[model samples]
Target: MHHADLFGPVDAGLPEGLVYRPDFVTAAEEAALIDHVAALPFAPFQFHGFEGNRRTVSFGMEYKFDGSGLKQAEPFPGWLLPVRDHAAALAELKPEDFVHALIIEYAPGAGIGWHRDRPVFGDVVGVSLGAEAPLRFRLKEGSKWRRFTLPAEPRSAYLLRGPARTEWEHSLAPVSALRYSITLRTLRAA
Candidate 1:
């Protein structure tokens, strides 16, 4: 059987509830955020018995993948209030609605695997900084899969909500250079 090349890369359209915006932050603002990130302490990301290559720090609420569950970290810092507000606006949510924040540092060649955000989280808003990486998405439909690659450019932001947030799984490709990202998540009400 011969496979059609057209079946591989789906350049047709993006998924629903997915919004991508380039140049979400100014150059000066990105630089300042990077400087602040550089000053903060970061710990190795821990998964279910594995240490991830990336370093991360969580604010508001930290979710433990070790089956331990969610725990509170520090409140959102004063410096991040404006950023949170902007991301919230893009996601059509209030800043207070985004109760969990994460700052991650990706070393060269470090990347995350395919996985969706936990069910406890409602929506995801992310800001990419310092460098660019491809954020890939996948959805399995029976025996077939649909995939899309999103370029997470520096100083850019994206919002994932509704079906995109629930039905699709997203991951990042390893970076060729050091990179930083900010993830703001809203919690689902019990």
Candidate 2:
């Protein structure tokens, strides 16, 4: 199928401001990116109160959530400029807008818990490689909950902005196989 057929308005009655584009990267690009990530030094993700099941290497401005808030780390590496530029173009965001990235590796059975990106960040964009996984979303409504799932296929990219960034929490279930993702974010204006 044509790549365009894979994209549409958010389904299942979810809020607006989400963009999912399949085949955002060609197969060749995917292979190169995977190889690049494989050569990087990956560290297990750890935070104040939680630890991630996946391994990650951050570039640009690394950010850590200190239980109550976000903390800044070293600047993103110069080597990441090319990938950042590509991701910004795919997400239709200006290059200057994306100031940070996290390259995460999900081994089989690795998955992230549900949570919102910190307020310090804006406009989350992610590129998926290696395998497909369901990106789940949930929002609390009084005593009930509303949920939705988006399949993130390899070579695809997704953008989360507006309501999709602020009003919902997102997560991935245990991955069935190896997968990698590059998540880019911009800092919110002071």
User: Residue 4: error of model 2 in Å?
Assistant: 27
**Alpha-carbon TM-score of each model against the true structure:** 0.94, 0.85
Please, what are the lDDT tens digits per residue for candidate 1 over residues 8-29? 6454467888999899999999
For model 2, what is the error of residue 158's alpha carbon versus the real structure, in angstroms, after optimal superposition? Answer: 0.6
Which parts of model 2 have CA positions greater than 4 angstroms off? 1-11, 66-79
Q: List the residue pairs that clash in candidate 2.
A: 59-76, 60-75, 60-76
Predicted structure 1, TM vs. truth: 0.94
Q: What RMSD does model 1 have?
A: 2.5
User: Candidate 2's residue-wise lDDT over 99-190, tens digit each?
Assistant: 77889999999999889998889889999999899998877777755677889999998889888899988999889999999999988778
RMSD of each: 2.5, 5.7
